[model samples]
Target: MAKFEILSLITSLLAIFVSCLALYRSRKTHSELVEFEKVHVKLSRRQIEEYEAKDAARQKTTLGAKLIDSGGIRLQVSNLGEASAKDIWIRIEDPDSYNPLVSGDYKQKIPYPSLNPGEDFTLTAFIPLSVTQQVYPIALRWLNEDGTQGDFRCTVSR
Candidate 1:
C-alpha cells in the first residue's frame, strides 16, 4: 500500500514537470512567430533614376553637358515582404536645398497610400537642374495590414 502511494506521488510530479516544459516551449514559439511576422511587411527603396534634357543640336555632341535646363528624378518604393502595407507616406527632409518640383499636396505628404506584397510604387517629379548627383534625406511612414506602424529613414541620390 505504501509503495502504491509513493508511485502515485512520483507520477503526479512528473506530469506537472512535463506540463511546465510544454508551456515554456509554447510561449517561446509564440514570441518567435511574432518576430517573424514583422519581417513579412517590410518596405524598401528599390531604385532611383535621374533624367536630364540637353540643348538641341548640341545634344548629340555633348553627352556630358553641364547645363541642364530641365530634369527629373524617379524613385521606386517596393514592399519586399509577404504582407500588405497601408497609409504609406513619403517626405523630403530638406525641400529648400533639394527643391524637388512638388505640388502643394505633395509638399504636405506624398501618399503612396498602399502597397501589396511584392508590389512597388514609382514616384517621379520634375526637379531643378541643380538637384543632381546629391543625396537627399527622406522619411517614409506606413502601417502594416495588421495595424503595426513603421517609419524608415532613407536617402535618394540623383
Candidate 2:
C-alpha cells in the first residue's frame, strides 16, 4: 500500500475514535445534569406542597374570639380550619382598653387543636366577675403563623 493511503486511513481511524469518545462524554454529562435538575424539581415540589397544605387549611374562615353571655365569661373561639393548627393563639381584649384579658399562652398551639368540617370546638373558660366587669366592649383576636389575623367585638353592653 502507498504511504499516503496508509496515512489517510490512520487519520480516518483517529477521527472516528475521537468522535466516539466525545459522544460518550456528552451523554454522560447530559444524564448528570438531568438527574440534578430532577432532584431540584422534586425538592421544590415538596416545599410547595407543605406551604400549600398549610395555606389551604387556613383558607377563608371566620376566625375570631367572642365572649358569650352564658353567665360567666364564656370565651368561644374558632379556628375555622379542617387540618390541625400548628401554632394558633387567641387573645381576649378588654373593650375599655386594648389589654389582653386572656391569651393562648398554653403549651398547645390551638385551643381546640382540630376543627372539623362545620364542626368547631369551643372552650368555655370562665373568668371571675372581677376580670369580666373590669373590661367592657370586649374584643376577640385570633393569630396564627404570620400575616394571619381576625378580630371581632361583642354586642353593646347592657
Q: Each prediction's Cα lDDT score?
A: 0.60, 0.55
Q: Would you list the clashing residue pairs of candidate 1?
A: none
Model 1 agreement with the true structure over 1-158: per-residue lDDT tens digits: 69999999999999999999999999999999988776653321111111222222212210000112234455567776556667777767676766453566454545666677767765555566655647667776777655667677767665
Clash count per candidate: 0, 0
lDDT of 1 at 73: 51
TM-score of each: 0.47, 0.41
Against the true structure, candidate 1 has what lDDT?
A: 0.60
Predicted structure 2: clash tally: 0
lDDT of 2 by residue, 1-158 (tens): 99999999999999999999999999999999999999999999999999998776565344544556666545555555443332335544444443433344333434344443355444445455455544445444544343365455653231
The candidate that wins on lDDT is: 1
Which numbered prediction scores highest in TM-score against the true structure? 1
- Deviation from truth (RMSD, Å), model 2: 9.6
